[model samples]
Target chain A: MRIADAGDPLMGQLVARYGAEEALAQVREGRLGPGFVAEIAARRGKPIDCERRLAAWRARLPYVDAEADLARGEELGARLVVPGDVEWPTQLDDLHHERPLGLWLHGSADLRFACLRSVSIVGSRAATPYGVHVAAELAAGLSEAGWTIVSGGAYGIDAAAHRGALAGVAETIAVLACGTDVAYPAGNHGLFEGMRARGLLVSECPPGVRPTRIRFLVRNRLIAALTRGTVVVEAAIRSGALSTAGHAVKLSRHVAAVPGPVTSGNSIGCHRLIRRAEAVCVTTTHEVIELMAAIGDDLSPEPRAPVLPRDRLDAESRSILEAVPSRSGAGPATIAVSAGVDLMTTLSHLGVLAAAGYVERTDHGWRLRRST
Target chain B: MRIADAGDPLMGQLVARYGAEEALAQVREGRLGPGFVAEIAARRGKPIDCERRLAAWRARLPYVDAEADLARGEELGARLVVPGDVEWPTQLDDLHHERPLGLWLHGSADLRFACLRSVSIVGSRAATPYGVHVAAELAAGLSEAGWTIVSGGAYGIDAAAHRGALAGVAETIAVLACGTDVAYPAGNHGLFEGMRARGLLVSECPPGVRPTRIRFLVRNRLIAALTRGTVVVEAAIRSGALSTAGHAVKLSRHVAAVPGPVTSGNSIGCHRLIRRAEAVCVTTTHEVIELMAAIGDDLSPEPRAPVLPRDRLDAESRSILEAVPSRSGAGPATIAVSAGVDLMTTLSHLGVLAAAGYVERTDHGWRLRRST
Candidate 1:
């Protein structure tokens, strides 16, 4: 299962069956269970012979040099956490379509705990002074409120967020698109090094991986998935910071956008987001804190309010309620499919439940009546 | 009756009753009815005799010498229009509580036409280049769409708005708080002169009156009343442009505010207005034009949609419809008072109307359904 054991016979079988890219895509898609990727390769007609692929994989190891890089990372006191590890954040499981294969972590803080109360602070690299000041204030306030800060290790708003968090006695996490050891933007070397020393620097890419535009966009998903919310301090209409907001929304995480002067292009994206109602308008740290608090317990499966008198329900009603996902706000058809019942049965039960105040229809869809 | 006939016996009567300051206040409030001072004086104690006050008023006449100044303005081809004159703008009638006494005018554009189709464009005097550019574009677009631009003849956004409007086929109007013969800022003399030539420069005070803080605020009412809408491009929270917006709202004119970056203090006032629902968010000339079109036929006594249906109605229904104002939305109690019927009768009719789909209840109150 470890990437280190390239010479193991099973590695050849896995690669031959799934092909390298397809296998990686499957793993990212969460469809390739542990030890099952080889089955997919056989189905694809590759019929990978484990022994031969393993030999070829070993022969190419010297040039790939992943083992040596892993050794170096471990020597530097960093831990490698793969997808199935206990410390892996479950919230990140939301990125089911584009999940990372593994993460390189260099820090002391528990990644899961860090993510539970974390918020990503992102903005344009060429941020104005007002943007920087507002970003720093937001970071400091969130950190002081017992939340972990998350950001890129670049200059401008990113560096400010990390610095603000450090100032508040709380550490931050820097998620880089490139390798953990390399700082792509040379000007941000000091900030990258500072984060590694006192906070955490994480990357899905192997050591020595160079930063690319595509990688930056891909990295946005990780930042969005690893936090409770994303706060965009300032961004031009075409700035990549909006990518993080887009991913945050897809993952159903809270996205808070700051407002700026309509005259400034830097704030155009944020204003557009507010106007479209894709993000809540946040002018101060207090609003950000309130948004976080509202969604704070959303990740858990614990009843948001309480089980709405389900004990007195009939079998059909109980089945329909049970079929509803804790947070997905399921409709009657989806509930029926999940409950293995016909649509009519589900609808009838839902109608009764609704009439009895056991469930309610909301703008979001339908859900058990929390007020009940 | 006329200011020039100082030797008339009515002059003594005016001085005996009104004095100078009281008369000016009454004039500013638009309550100086014709011959009011003469009638009041005639009603007061014994035979009215005011030789001393008349002499003082005549001496003070030099300071209020609008006629002498008018000769200079006339030499410049400008005319003055006092309140109640045939050519006076009817829109100014909206300033019931803070009306101006008169307007000094320059240019051939009809005052009434300009007022009916005008939109006041105001912003910070120390506007940024972006603000100035947006103001110009907005003004030009509005003018091209047949809107007459109205603004204070100052620097930054105001100057840009006038210039942009002049560039288009539709001319603009400048309302100055200073005398029509004087440019208050001094630096804008060129703009002032250009406006006088191609557009119009108007003032409430007489030709020689100097600009003061009080006059500037009072002058805002003219800009607000003379326009169908007001667009605030940029303003700090306490900027005087907001006063114009207040007047626009009071005059029942459409208030459209442009959104800006929240980080910029210049946009904070506009943002607050939008948030409070005092102004609709507008980003382009089309939106402004649409808003104006939506508020068409401004003088129609019944501009609002009727709330109730008349088809298949009885005496109670007719009574209810009669009780409702053609313009103002009314509740049961107010309807009862206006209909001279009991509260229960009004409520009963409202219930029938609601059931018949003639009226709709809303969170604010109630409104007539658009269709019967």
Candidate 2:
């Protein structure tokens, strides 16, 4: 928890080399390896006192109480899921050194199982009604199709997506920048309660830790890593939602954006992603599935036109039918001559066409069947 | 004019084999080549009497008067644009043997020159108001960008495109299924008149010929071939506009479709085209231009966000700016420690940041600039 916000490469390298327990012990004793002092100096472009840098870690050594933090989480019905826990999602490891040391999970659902087939729905907090509606509907449809929905529990599109998914059968996860027990926005307090009971509220921040601007940005990487893909519902050209999409791209996860009206300012980011070939343009659940699902598993059916009786006819039959008069009937021989077909073949086709209601027998001969 | 409606492979093959006049002479004199009967028989899957088929052509001999046809076209203020005419769009030859023998044109603008840099905008005739608005806006923008607009002279989207283009500085062409002298819809008479005065109305039919379903289908090929690309503004899944897109694809022309709300049935064809990779998804005039314009030419500037003073900062400067307090002031030494930079670098960047309106020196030290 102390190191959750420490994304520094130098600290990460030390933790990776000595392992967490030995690294923590070394940091407390101010003995962080033999060559680490020179490496930190090289990275910082200066050869200052390494002991001064280690002072910050020593200052918090007395307050580093793991038992108290775990008990506080247990009091809130949350659990600490470490790297080797059964409930820890393995996909987060794809972040390498940037991955959280531990995840604070608050929910009834098993996090790892739910995330095995999941997609994140994210967008701007100031989304228009069109975006909100689309996000909710898409989440509902995806949930109904048995896929989990993941998102940051912010306002606008995020809230709508969680609400929509909650109304469906599948679980939804909210990867928060603050502690799972804390509702930073306050407006989403009720929504957070609902998620705690039904799905999951996940965060790297320990109990009582509040969200900051930098935390929100860092939190986006978790949302992208936990899912099979990330869908940006509506975002401005410079929205933070684009940061999540960028994380998804870097993670090699499928990235898709929902297209809306060109006149809508909110759709510009989505359109830009599509135009740049950074994301696929997806409008429906089926299309999203087609992008994220295994190949040949969730292929959407081809767009089809309403079928007409005439569509079933073979080419030769269509030619013969064209020769049949619409209003007036003509003799078989006359129709054959106009159709440029042999009389016997034309006569056989006429009988078949008449039986199929494409034509009817008149006093003169066969004519097109008129709908009455 | 006599063979304008005869789009048969046999007739086209004969015209390619011999020149038009010589081919007509052979038909008139009943002197079709010695091997012609076998080829026709092989294509039709039967041996029929050749004389009976030639009789239809010979029967129209009295009505095939080139002088009268040319005079009628002149009376309507239209001109015959043969293959070699300077006003004929050579791009139409991309249709290969399916290309029309001649085009009847009525307008002030040069057809070939106008078509040199043009894009056709097509959609369903029963377009929604949203479709109509988008079509007009796209056409107007494209026209303002100096690209000529081409479309069928139908109601709804087609009429809106022409009207929008007319409102701009560029000419707009209406490629009609009927003769240039006839306005099939009657309701678009005013729109057609405006086009004839400022741009070209082109067709393969003679002066009095009316439009039929098949003629409309065949005419779409001309519109697709006469432009650099085709943009379907809005369309139903089975729309005739898709046929135009298909023709454009067959001719290897750039095909683009504007995206709309998924809630709209009218946008189905456009979305399907994009999903199938049959068309590039275009949302703005610049995007359309980017698709049709040559590489390294007319490329749209990347989507930009409202710039902030901080956006221009270098990495070290951004770090220093982040360390600067938003509400309270901090000394340069304090900020340097927070920003992990040297005191000299922080002091230099703080001065530059102050000049750029990103920070202001305060009574204590320095704080972020507050917009008034």
Candidate 3:
């Protein structure tokens, strides 16, 4: 592992020292970090607050110790994932200039693989029981179908979603506003540990930072960007969940909403989105998957997930893909047995792979595609 | 009123004798009625069944007496309104050839005036309390806003809507499947009387005819065509209420549906409509009025019925209109006192008059528009 002084000066170390906004300013100016502060000063149309921001960062510099924080993260069993790292989720690149400098991840699951075919399920912290029920069911169904569920790890609907994915014994990622190791809500500490054992707990902040109200809002974009589509379970008219849905729309990701009782204040935002034609109304988890699928053919409303492409496939999916023969092909059972994967997973993968063009369904079973 | 013999012989008497299909075939062949039988026989490439239908009609003609039916309707205290009558609702013209030959009306309210700025509220007869609540609330709100509410006077949701309008002291038309004189759902005989007392009970069939199951389905089109918009409060996937919404869509009228608990099977049709982007999802009465009001201009879901012109105004609205001055406007209280109407009704009529372009809102109160 590269220490602050040992490796590229333009890494998470600079971000931890200068703060993400200042670090982001440097990146926007095509200057890597503080080393190129003079170059940013020379650039035309640079933010007028640049000097003030730079001075503030300079003042805070002595107190910032990136190497020590990195050590702390390492001690806490967390890994730093910079832009070029294998675990970095590429969908965050949709944010471009606003993308985080790096992520601090906790848990064993590969973040990139987990998000390969993922959908975000999110809603209000003050969710109604109906909201909680729908969120959990949708997450569970999507997870069981081999698609990962992503959510901000908060109380209410988010907590329900995480439990649902785990209940299905499927992959999940809990993106947090606070440090992944810090239990901000306290009540969800057990859930945090559960997610760490199964899925991943992700955060943009360094180790030991606490969550603020603003941080939760700041964290919503990541949840939206990490997934192919987002299903808003339920939200009040001005719920923060709407901001996540807005982000997904700006990113050109399909946004779906579950309808609820109109009388319930929890459903107002969903109905508003639907009435405005801003989001498609979805009732079942199957419908959410249909919308999340890469293929847009078969315009009918019947729930059918499009196949996951090879590049979007998870590690196990790729391994399973290789197990299928090009000529005679293989029965799903044969493929599952050979790949050392479960029958449900093998079938799920084959359905998507056949849809994605990597394989074809043969009279016997499944075979590698002639084109690919 | 002219007996059917003195009027267009091509009207209901022939249809009643030979059936609508056979009579329509004769009409399509350029035959007016049995009087034009020779002309139909003379036509080349005429339908082979024409003569048989014509003979059947002629044989039944001896049993058909238009004068007696007219007398029967009159004796029932119902007025027979054929096409071209001042009391006829012209929006029904949207049906073209499928338009009813005449309407039997039982009420003191003018039919044309009652439907001028009307909305049809309909839903499943097997409505849940939630459906009934929403339908009634929506109907009452529309009624209080000076818009007439129209509905089929059946049990459940239909009964709720009619009663809701009456409770609001607003005009409502009950488009019946059977003769206006006969209440088909005997349970709602009291509701039918209430409608006749406060609004109108309308039927296309002559007096003494019974309601067939097919007749209810056939009558749904009239409800859709008679109003500026149709609000489907609640419906199952196969609810006949959807048929009315479908007819509204076909006729280019605004169609809206109320959102309900997604778990309820009763809301399936409404959810389907909203999900398919076929109907606007409305919750509040304010939203419904905003949809129905023309003054919203482009903000409305559609530009539908302008307010009925002053000449088409009901006797009370006309009196209220006269009470407002051309130069100096008057408050609703003053206008109501002068017009011998209640303040609430006066205010409601003024809102419509302002929307209709006959009146303008001034700093003083309400005034006749310079154009009108």
Candidate 4:
């Protein structure tokens, strides 16, 4: 038996209301598909029809109003992306029944494309200065090399990671435990704004939802599944970063840890992971790229001339490209001021230039693509 | 084809005069046994009989003055320990043809027994304060656990190791590049005297010899081979400590490294060793012992009641034992004054008490063995 496509849009709402997992398990186990909920509702008096469950589920629908949630999401410039959507990252399909009922995306970069070249860098919220520095530098390096940096986007190492990616002019993704509209920590509101401008803010929860402790752990699996690998920069033995690493390990994805002084309590988890051979000890961006690309010919995609043809780009893209330095990249704000374009227009043109391969990100910021 | 042990002991002096390494290869490769040297002397007219080499070898011997060198060693209260002697550490046999013909020693500890359970800790002569602290603390921990600490007798990390072992009252052997009596650095004069009273100061070079750059490197193999394992505390990428770790690896002995800040130059070699899987990463003395002891019931040698019988000890040993506090160990000088014995006598009795397991070294000083 297969889940029917017709029931999905409404069923998706019902599932979201009940939090997809338990309802999906029932639908799967009973071979109920397509019109299952309606069939159960119609066969209410039958013992096998889940009559009482259907009533309880229907009673909750008045509280949901799927169309209104969808309309509100649209109003916020966010979208409810269900299975089979073109923008959906097929990687999530690996989770099978546990896949989100739908993702709530609130930014411009294409989710699938951004994650095609991405890694998740996460660590402790109470990170030390050294940890923050390492996380930022490592994320910046990976970003400069064209990999999107994905993180939980709360504070400390996570905030540093997202900010570093933005500084590199590479798309950064924040897969939050709360709604895309809500920056849970509030401390990272500014960082969230920067990401939404040039990167993405994503979540499984719909609009207006708040984060909980269990939600963060559930969110970690999404962070791990969204990227090619996970790098734990600095984490105490009990840090939440370990949950993401654990998920990555279980999913058979690449897992690595940046080593720090054995004296630092913040580095205990990373050291322990390395000591037990659970994670590769990585100290540089190149090492991390190597770990993720071990079985591929991609080889961290060596620096080479840009792939986009010059004749195809628009005048604005050329202007933005000309404003960008060939090395030691410039930020969008600086580039916009230098290029005589407004920041929003300059950002849109820069995005086009990046996608067209006419420009690239570096640890510093955006730069023209490597010269032919 | 065995190396003929019957070669003249004076011929041994002649062999030693040129150093056995380069010239002995010809003697070994030729498969010549006993009387081969005499036959070479009788067949001196033949070109390949090594006539010129032997003449040069014999010429250097008059300068050696074997009897005088022996007497000077005796005057220094030293003894000659050849391979077959009961005092020779059998681990040195792993060096094969490269092994020293004999070792010169000036100390009280039994060379063989002291090394029966030992680890060599060595690193840069220009070690940072972190390196010194790590080296000293590591050595003390091992000493307290009843493992002898072996090291080179140079400045910096080496000096710190020996002093820490002495403080623990656990024997520490200093394998010198020059004659044991010379104390090449001279700065460690006091340290040498302390070790000589309770540990061992050893060298392959005979009396009247001074240290040279080549001698220290050749000496490193002996230090590496003398112990159950070698731990490089901190070293530059090209520091001589790596040579000892390499020798340990080649001998199939366990090799470990104490990790430190990667930003520090002193820890580069250790990090490199760990990166290349050439050594196990160890942060504590117990981990070192674990790597060295993979089999048998010696699993960290579980803490238990002292094995030494109290009734069997001699009167002086009893006095020294009684003088050693049960906690917060006492120094030999202080213990000597308290036990009513001379310093030298107190050290001798302490060594006996340590060997019998009635006492053990702690980072601070000698302490009564764990009771119950």
- Reported per model, the fraction of native interface contacts reproduced equals 0.17, 0.32, 0.25, 0.10
For candidate 2, what is the recovered fraction of reference interface contacts?
0.32
DockQ of 2: 0.36
| Model 4 ranges with Cα > 4 A deviation | A1-62, A294-372, B1-59, B294-372
TM-score against native, each model: 0.56, 0.88, 0.71, 0.68
Candidate 3 residues lying further than 4 Å off, grouped into runs, are A1-47, A297-372, B1-49, B52-63, B295-372
Ranking by TM-score: 2, 3, 4, 1
Per-prediction TM-score, chain B alone: 0.64, 0.83, 0.69, 0.68
Which of the numbered candidates is closest to the native, going by highest TM-score?
2
Q: Cα lDDT for residue B331, model 4?
A: 89
Local distance difference test scores for all models: 0.70, 0.84, 0.76, 0.75
Tens digits of per-residue lDDT for model 1, B254-280: 897787655577777776676556887
- CAPRI docking class of candidate 4: incorrect
Give the per-residue lDDT of model 3 (tens digit) for A98-213. Answer: 57777889997999999999999999899888888888888898888888889988888899999999888678898887787885688988988888898999987788866654
Cα lDDT tens digits, model 4, B1-372, are 012111223335435445455445544343334565665456455534344333323323324456777888888899988877998887876876566678888999999999988899999999998889888988888888788999998899899999888878579999998788787899999999998998999987777666655568778988889998999988887688999999999998888887776557788788767767888877667677787765753454322223446657775566567668888988897776545455777888888888877889889999988861
Candidate with top DockQ is: 2
DockQ of 1: 0.06
Better-scoring candidate (DockQ), 2 or 4? 2
At residue A272, give the lDDT of candidate 1.
Answer: 66
Candidate 1, residue B70: lDDT: 73
Give residue B70's error in model 2 in angstroms: 3.0
